[model samples]
Target: MLIIPAIDIKEGKCVRLTRGDFNQKKIYLDNPRDMAIIWRKQNAKMLHIVDLDAALTGEMTNFEKIREIVTDLDIPVQVGGGIRSVDAVKRYLDIGVSRVVIGSAAVTDPKLVERLMKIYRPSQIVVGIDAENGIPKIKGWTESSGLKDFDLALRMKSMGIERVIYTDISRDGMMQGFGYESTKRFAERAGMKITASGGVTNAEDMKRLIELQPYGVDSVIIGKALYECNFPCQELWYAFEEGITLDHNFSTARKK
Candidate 1:
């Protein structure tokens, strides 16, 4: 499974939100491109980026910053947030984003997905289905869509959307642990390939997610765990080359 790091851009900076609350954001880097470069250096195969400003207001707030990150990294970068129309999706793809994720647009306008899919290959499209209490939330998790998360997933699948980024908003950025039960159940019912997000705290979490691969959970988007070193540190990549054993009790790469 690919463990992708998230570079959530709020006002052109790297940040994380608690439970999708914009007010509780924590800025970690001034230049999101730096974080993207850091992840690439760690041998990450892909990256996930969310435009917070666009998510809230449906604006292209970080297009330039996103463009720069995609240009700097050799790996694929999938971008989401405020990509509601075909124009926005085309813009991102035209600018070299490997994939474009649609959230509110998927929920609010199912036809748009169909339209985009007709123009682009399914591999270039992804639907971000972020939920709380089993119900999907939109408009940056501040509003309810009144749609059952599983039902919506099924609907998207019916629309020819084969991939989804499922996030349990309640567990997002909390670092407690992934919501395995809810996530597994959602994946089983969604009947589509899912990229798990929210509350991925450590290597153990990655192992457990591996166990859930059977349910169509293919990849995971990790945020705070990576930034805070709750997972096995990126240093382990080099340690593996040095023939060093990285145990649970081993000293971490980060000083904190």
Candidate 2:
């Protein structure tokens, strides 16, 4: 299973919103690019980035910052947030983003996904299903799509979407625990590979997710816990690099 680190950009700063609540955000790093380098130094296989400002406003507010991180990191980076149009999707991929995650568009514009699938390989496009109480939420979790999570996942699967990032909004950033059952059910019903997100607090949560790997839950996106050093591994990494400067160009052997 892949342990992906998440860097959510709001107003050009790396921040984490509690329970998807924009009003309750905590800034972790002033420069998101630096945070990306730290994750790379700590051996993150893939990095997950979300432009929170764009997610709510539907504008690529942090595009330049994201592009900078993408340029600096050798690891694959998957980005999501306000990627509503085909042009926006192309823009991200054109800049060498490994994959572009479609969120609101996946719910509001199903045909857009169909059209994108024809142009881009399935591996290059991902659908983000953010849900609250089984109903899929769109536009940065501010509105509900009036469709169940499973329904949305099934719809994307029918459109040839091979993988989805499933986030349970209620548990997001709470650090209470993960929505394991909800994620498992979504994967089982949709019959597609899932990258679970939201409220992954500690090692027990990770262990639970590992148990569901057989059900198509292969990886997870962790934000707050990682930033706050919820895992022991992070503690060690931080201690070892406390005074040492990081070489941003440091590279990991690419996984085959």
Q: How well is each residue in 1-256 modelled by candidate 1, as lDDT tens digits?
A: 7778899999989999999998999999999999999988776778999999999999999999999999888989999999999899989999899999999988899999999989999899999999998999998988999999999988889888999999999899999999999999998888889999999987777778888999999888989988997655555343323343444434443545
The positional error of residue 140 in candidate 2, measured at the CA in angstroms, is: 1.0
Consecutive 10-residue window with the lowest summed lDDT within model 1 = 236-245
| Predicted candidate 2 versus true structure: per-residue lDDT over 76-157, tens digit per residue | 9999999999999999998989999999999888999999999999999999999988898989898989998988888888
Highest TM-score: which candidate? Answer: 1
**Which regions of candidate 2 are displaced past 4 Å?**
234-256
Clashes of 2: 0
lDDT of 2: 0.88
